[model samples]
Target: MGRLSTHILDTSNGRPAKGVRIELFALEGDKRHPVATEMTNADGRTDAPLMTGATFRTGTFELLFHVGEYFRSFGAPLSDPPFLDVVPIRFSIAEPDGHYHVPLLVSPWSYSTYRGS
Candidate 1:
C-alpha cells in the first residue's frame, strides 16, 4: 500500500526542522479544501502519513510550510518580509498507489524538494 509523507531539513543548521507548522490542502477549481495540519516531529517528519491507502486521492494538493517563524525562533537575521515565509509546495499524485515522499531541504533564503520513495 502506498502513502504520502514529508519531512523537513533545515539546511542552515544541518538538522531536522522540528516544530515547524505544516498544512495540507486539496485543490479543486479555485477552492482549497483543508485536509490535514501537523507539526514536524523531532526527526523532522510527521508522526503519520498525510494520506494513505483508501484515503489517498490522485490530483492536485498543496503543502504549506511556515518557515519564517521557524527561522526567527532560532534568531536568524532576515528581512521584515522574509525571503521564504509560507513555502507552498504544490504537486499531484499521478499514481496514488505509489509512495510519495516529499521532503523539503530549506533555509531562510532557499529551499528544495523532490519526490522520493
Candidate 2:
C-alpha cells in the first residue's frame, strides 16, 4: 500500500512551483543511483507517483528540487550564488506499507518538507 509522491509550493510567490524539475535517487552506501526525473505540472505535482506498489522499497532515497532555476525563470533576481539552488531532501522509508507524501514548501531563501498524508 505504500507509495512515494511529492509536490512543491513556492512560498515566496504563494503558488505552486510549476514546471520545476525533480530528481529521485536511491542511496546505497557512499553513492546514489538515479531512479527517475520529472517536471512538475501546473499543480506542482507529477502526473504519477514517483514510486508505488512493487517498485517502492524500504531504503534511503533523495529528492532533488531545482529551485534556483525555477525562480530565475520568473525573473527573480537572486544572489550570485543563489541562497537556495538545488534543494535536496533525503529520507528513509522503513515501512513498505506506509504512504510517503513528501511535500516541499520552498522559497528563494528557504525550504521545508515533512511526511504528509
Candidate 3:
C-alpha cells in the first residue's frame, strides 16, 4: 500500500517521471497552503512519503501535477491546445494512521488515478 508515501506513473512513456515537481497542499477554510514539495524519483515516487508517521493528518489535500510540461519534456507530441493541461488531483485522508496509495496513470489526452496498493 502507499502508506504515508505515494507514487505516480506516466503510462504514456511506460516509465517513471523523474524530476517531476510535485506540490502538496492542505485545504483549509478556502485557503490552500503548501504543506510539502518534492520531485518524483526514477521510480515515479518521492524520496520520502508526503506524510511522515508523526504528522499524517486527516483532511482534504491537493496534488498539483505539471503534466503538460512533463509530456513535452518526454517528447510526446500534443495537439494545438492539448487536452490535458495542469492536472489537480484532490482527495481526503480519512485515516492518518493508514497507508494511502494514490497512483496516477496519465497521458496527454487522458488520465486516471485511484487508491492503489
Candidate 4:
C-alpha cells in the first residue's frame, strides 16, 4: 500500500526547519480536506506518514509550508512583503503501492521539489 510522507529543509540555514508547520490535505474535486497536521522534528521528518497502509489512495494532495514564519522566526532579513509566503506543494499519487518521497528544499526566495524514490 502507498503512504504519504514529507521532509522540509531550510536552505537558508542549511538545516531542518524544526518546528515548522506542515499540513497535509487530500484534494477532492475542487475542495481540499485536512488529512493531518505536523511539525518537523530535529531531523526534519514527521513522526509518521500522514497516512499509511491500505487506507492510502491515489489522488492529488497538497503540502502547505509555513516558510514565511519559519524565516521570520530565525531573523532572516526580508524585503518587507517577503517574496516567498506560504509554499503550496501540489502533486498527485499515481500508485497506491508506490513509495513517494516529496522533499522540500526551501529558501526565502525560492524552493524546489521532486518525486524522490
Enumerate clash totals for all models, in the order shown.
0, 0, 3, 1
Give the poorly placed runs of model 2, Cα more than 4 Å off. Answer: none
Scored by TM-score, the top model is 2
**Candidate 1 local lDDT, 1-115, one digit each (tens):** 7789999999999999999999999999999999999999999999999999787889999999999989998799899999999999999988868899999999999999999
Give the C-alpha miss distance for residue 92 in model 3, angstroms.
0.6
Q: Provide the global lDDT of candidate 1 against the true structure.
A: 0.93
Candidate 4: tens digits of C-alpha lDDT, residues 26-112: 999999999888988898888888778966888999999888888898799987899987899999999878888888999898999
> What TM-scores do the predictions have?
0.96, 0.97, 0.88, 0.92
Local distance difference test values of all predictions, in order = 0.93, 0.93, 0.79, 0.86
Query: What lDDT score is found at residue 83 in candidate 3?
Result: 80
Clashing pairs in 2: none
Model 2 misses residue 43 by how many Å?
Answer: 0.5
Superposed model 3: Cα runs more than 4 Å off = 1-3
If the candidates were sorted by their lDDT against the true structure, best first, what order would they fall in? 2, 1, 4, 3
Q: Give residue 97's error in model 3 in angstroms.
A: 0.6
Q: What RMSD value applies to candidate 4?
A: 1.2
